[model samples]
Target: MDSRRAFLKKTLISGTGMALSGSLMPQSLLAASSKKITILHTNDMHSRIEPFPDDGGTFANMGGMARRATLISEIRAKEPNVLLLDAGDIFQGTPYFNFYGGELEFKLMSKMKYDAATLGNHDFDNGMDGLLGQLPNASFNFISSNYDFSDTLLHNQFSAYKIFNKGGIKIGVFGLGIELEGLVAKENYGNTKYLDPIAVSREMVQQLKNKKCDLIICLSHLGYSYQSQKIDDRKLAAQVNGIDLIIGGHTHTFLDHPEEIINKDGHKTLINQVGWSGLKLGKIDFAFGKKNEISYANSEPLAII
Candidate 1:
């Protein structure tokens, strides 16, 4: 891996691109078919079926699945193409998880029409069989590009990437999970091989590019930036090219807006994470027109009130 500065310098010389990469707009949200798309995303929801009580605290009376559904419905009513995504940690936390063991979570997300989600360390709380047992409840796809579940019960439960067609725009989406060694118990994730995120990302990006996708998104449970050497969303962005945006979780960091980074190819990628507990829904509106023509890629934090 080259130093970021060195990579940036080579990119400049070879015209690998400084703003956008590979003959395409990096952060496109709209397609040229006179259609607009809305991306609705959440992360680390942690089974909060109901909002927090009005306990006179920071999250008082906020983050209920009902409110989130209403908001999503409203958006779908207005937008022609909308994609709802979650970045894992859909299990555990609240009493609902303790009582229902994630059935309700999957059912609710299915009812809300979630497009896809990734895996988080906590999703393995009850072990592989536990998660495999609950798979029948989720209507959406689970994508984990780096977690090799070939030897586990989850072998047939997920795919590495999914391509979406929205208003004529082909969007390539994949998932990446955090390393689970210190995070999850050994028995819980038995025989699930952890692949190198960077390598997997590189491969997935090439596949997506070959598929000729207009935009690429990563549903990541790898958290946001960390001060330590622990790999995070920032590292993913800096190392890989072709991923247009990253919807992240695991760290529970709240951002007023998405963070932008220049990738290995010198293209821009946006990283966004709404605070956990379903209190806030991340909304980004995209308009696509003309090849290689850049759009401002809207990033708005929509409160589910």
Candidate 2:
């Protein structure tokens, strides 16, 4: 065990651009009764179906769906338990969205086999009807806890939360969207009621706990932070308990590492976000003990080269 710990410490220190966080237990300590889950996530893709042109811009020739797909495939080939998720803004930005109304984007994500996604304000750029029209192109679910679509055409189209069993470990995931009133046009998101994220998060935690999930994740479209009183991922992490991780979007913040914040119950919650346009894919590996308790976690953002 001591040798394993020393090895892990040395590897971490030698690893470039890797941020080792959370409670870490040496792999040897739990090798006989441990499982590891790798979470691959993205945010604010905004309809970037192809790589940026080699036009000498900052992100020139950087982000592309094809590169991301190849990277994800490579990881899945090596990892037994993996989850691919998005924090939303899947539509609106490139000419592709304008031409196809998000059909191409959804199709590509479906091809990549995304497990789930949340809603971003820009997702409503073409309105609810447009979003509904492209639903058939997607193979995965959309989970949004705070946005009530009861009276819209999107009623019952999304889940408040979903549970998954990966390698005998139960993982719970829920979603939260930014308030769309002013950011989104009234006609675009007609009749969709925005609920309080904090309140909904507390309820989700209790419900997932009752369901005996070992890990709970929040797919949040809330911005990373704000000077004003607007609720952001950081604020949500500080106020809520029981959320193991918060995958954030909407502000297009590029975080090289996941920020660890102690929550209301004094438990640690991790928050991470990659900038918009599919430039980077955030990866977090969590190791669980025999009892499904998280023993170790580490994060790194893989650039889509």
The best candidate in terms of TM-score: 2
* Candidate 1 Cα misplacement greater than 4 A, ranges: 1-33, 292-294
Q: lDDT per residue, candidate 2, 171-261, as tens digits?
A: 9999999999889999999999999999999999999999999999999999998999999999999999899999999999999889888
Highest lDDT scorer: 2
Q: What is the Å distance of residue 255 in model 2 from its true position?
A: 0.6
Candidate 2: minimum summed lDDT over ten consecutive residues — where?
Answer: 10-19
Clash count, candidate 1: 5
What's the count of clashing pairs in each model shown?
Answer: 5, 0
RMSD, one per candidate, in order = 12.7, 9.7
Whole-structure CA lDDT of model 1: 0.84
lDDT of 1 by residue, 93-190 (tens): 88888987888788778878899999999999989988998887788999999999989888878999999999788888999999999899999999
TM-score of 1: 0.88
Model 2 TM-score, 2 decimals: 0.91
